[model samples]
Target chain A: MRVLGVDPGLTRCGVGVVEGVPGRPCTLVAYYVVHTDPEDELPLRLLHLDRSLTDLVAEHRPDAVAVERVFSQHNVRTVMGTAQASGIAVLAGARAGLPVQTYTPSEVKAAVTGSGQADKAQMTMMVTRLLRLPEPPRPADAADALALAICHVWRGGTRSKLAAAAERARGGRTR
Target chain B: MRVLGVDPGLTRCGVGVVEGVPGRPCTLVAYYVVHTDPEDELPLRLLHLDRSLTDLVAEHRPDAVAVERVFSQHNVRTVMGTAQASGIAVLAGARAGLPVQTYTPSEVKAAVTGSGQADKAQMTMMVTRLLRLPEPPRPADAADALALAICHVWRGGTRSKLAAAAERARGGRTR
Candidate 1:
């Protein structure tokens, strides 16, 4: 399966794509971060994000998309900005007809580092090891995005099974 | 003086330009909303926004930019999307070499309605009355954007003075 992982932010977004068959390890195909000039108008920044993401999708053509889910935070401004970025990712994936999935920070950590509370450095180290890369990914955001992709690959099947079970439970109740 | 007002959002951004003269009412020069297909990727959306805003700026040549300051709420997804959109607006204004100003929703409402808690309909009516438009501006976001421009025209100087004073106070304390 080919998977694209995203770490969404208002000012910058990290993206990574991996491709692999069912029995083999996924290999990194591409990765980059989209940045908006901090001083630019909000609309223009979003425009840059939109254009860059579309180009990435078209070029990479991943079969599935994975994104980080936004959780509640104390900083209202920060939370708001993160949410906006997440929305863009979702919209992009939906538009491309890719099956989009979301993972929490804890889930990503647990999957990548064998612990739900793995720090950034640990996550980064684990991602490099898992991907069998000669060097770690540059820019912390990009590393986090790669780890998120790994998490999706590891947990995606279980997640689908749980979702199916929940759906069946609801259906049974209705009938 | 000319002011461009922007209401930034994920799918659409509303823009309005007004020319301000000392001791005279601001004149509406142009107004329009830019939109992106939700199905497109983030990069494509950003490109559409960038092209449209660049064109608008080149055509109208506003001297300054006024944008709404987003306040975060419960919806994490929505807030992040808005922030990305806001970033686009900021980048566009900076590219045009315009000094960008931001107004809180309360400030815009207060400037137009003499009440900070004014509803959208109330604010829209006031904006239409102030601009002497034949009808209310189409799209509530557009009207809110115009209100932001008007707010800047009415209170920008005072706000700047307050900001300067606050800066001076910080400088004195540091010394």
Candidate 2:
């Protein structure tokens, strides 16, 4: 499965595409940090993000999308921007007819680094090794996006399999 | 000027269209409550809102749009949904190439009822009177959408005049 991971934000949205199966190691197909001017109007900033994300979806054509879920923070303004960016990400996926999944920060960390509370460096190191990259992706957001995609490729695939198995078992019992 | 006002939400998004100048009392052209199934997936729910908002904008062809700004709340989950919905509203306006403005609940209430802290009944009563409606609009969200449109028609026009005057003054001094 090819999955796109989005760490949604107004100023800088991180996107990473990964290709792999559930139990196999995933490779990074592409990654980008889409930047928008903070001085721009809110709608314009959001528009830029929207267009960039839409273009990325068109280019990669991922099977599923994974986005970082917005959580409450001390700064309500910051959280609002994050939430807005996240909404755009989800909308982009929906527009492309792709199933989009949300993963919390901890969930992505746990899936990538085997610990929910792993530090940025640790998570980066794990992603690099897992993807067999020569160097670690920088600025944390890029690496985090890769982690999200990797997490979803594994987690979502497993969940689908389990759901299918459960359905089959129920049908067998009824018959 | 024709204006579209949106009260963003997950289950029910209120939309109202009005037409008038700053000093003149605005008339409500149309209003509707866009509803989505609570059991639907998040993406589908958002897609429904996106399409409905898009259709409304295309049908009315508003000169501007007013969306309720998402504010901080004690319930993080609820606030996230509101923020997401607000983003969708803003995006819809942007996609339609209309100038989008956001008004806080207090700002809308104050503009319509002379008090920022006006209760729902007071705001509804003022909206009904302002729009010359036969009775209070059902489902408070619809009334609030009208209130937002009224606030923008009055306040946005005043702000535009002030901005234009400032520009004139600046040009005179600079030249």
Candidate 3:
């Protein structure tokens, strides 16, 4: 399955596309950052982000979209911007008729680096090794986006398998 | 000027349209609530909201859009949802090339009721009286939305006047 992951932010939104099956190495389809000027008005900034994300989704055409869930932080203003950006990202996926999922930062870190508390360097290293890239992805946001996509692909696969197995078990009991 | 006011929420978004100039009783053109099932997935709920707000803007063709500025609250989850909803509302206005302005709850209260700390009942009462409506607008959200629109109209007018006065003073001094 191919998945698009978004690490949503107003100033810099990271987007990464990955193609792979569960329990296998993933291939990097593409990755980029969408930037908006902080000096611009809030509405204009949001509009630019919405359009950029819409175009990105159309170009990649991933099977599913995954976004990093925004959490409240001590910096209220920054968190608000992040939440707004993530909202636009989720709308982009839904508008394209694709299933969208959100994972916490820890979830992505655990999925990619085998530890929920892994540091940025560790996540970047793991992502580089897993994707067999010669160099690590620049900007921690990009690495986080890749981690989110990888997490969704693996978790989505496992969830479906578990559901199927449960159904089979129930059928056998009924029979 | 005609203004569209949005009090953004995920479950029930309040929208109100008003037409009038500053220093005059505003006329309420329309007011309604957009509802979304809370049980529905986040993306679907947001998509429904986006479409509803978009359609409302297109139909009303307001000169400006006013939205309540979301603030951080004790309930982090609710605040996040509010921020997200407000983001979509702002996008609706920006996409339509209308000037969008956000006013804090206190600002709206001060503009309508002459007190920043006015309670919900006071706000509703003042809005009804200001618009010359026979009854109070239902569902506190609707009243708050109307207050936002009223606030924008008056504030926008006053702000421009202040700018022009400052410009004239500067021109005189420079000459």
Compose the digit string of candidate 1's lDDT tens values, residues A60-86.
887777889876563555665676567
DockQ of 3: 0.68
Q: Pick the candidate with the highest TM-score.
A: 2
True contacts kept of each: 0.29, 0.69, 0.76
Preferred candidate (lDDT higher): 1 or 3:
3
Error of 3 at A72 (Å): 1.4
Q: What is the DockQ of each candidate?
A: 0.18, 0.70, 0.68
* Weakest 10 consecutive residues of candidate 2 chain A by summed lDDT: A166-175
Query: Model 3, A78-171: lDDT tens per residue?
Result: 9888988999999999999887888988888889988999999999999999889899998878888888888988896566457559878888
Error of 2 at B107 (Å): 1.2
Candidate 2 local lDDT, A7-43, one digit each (tens): 9888889999999998789998999999888877677
Q: Model 3's lDDT to the true fold?
A: 0.88
Off by over 4 Å in 3: A157-175, B157-175
Assess each prediction's global lDDT (C-alpha) against the native: 0.76, 0.87, 0.88
The CA lDDT at A156 in model 2 is 74
Q: What is the interface RMSD of candidate 2, in Å?
A: 0.9
Sorted on DockQ, highest at the top, how do the candidates line up?
A: 2, 3, 1
> Candidates ranked by TM-score, best first?
2, 3, 1
Better of 2 and 3 by lDDT: 3
B122-166, model 2: which lDDT tens digit per residue?
999998998999988989899999899999899975675676598
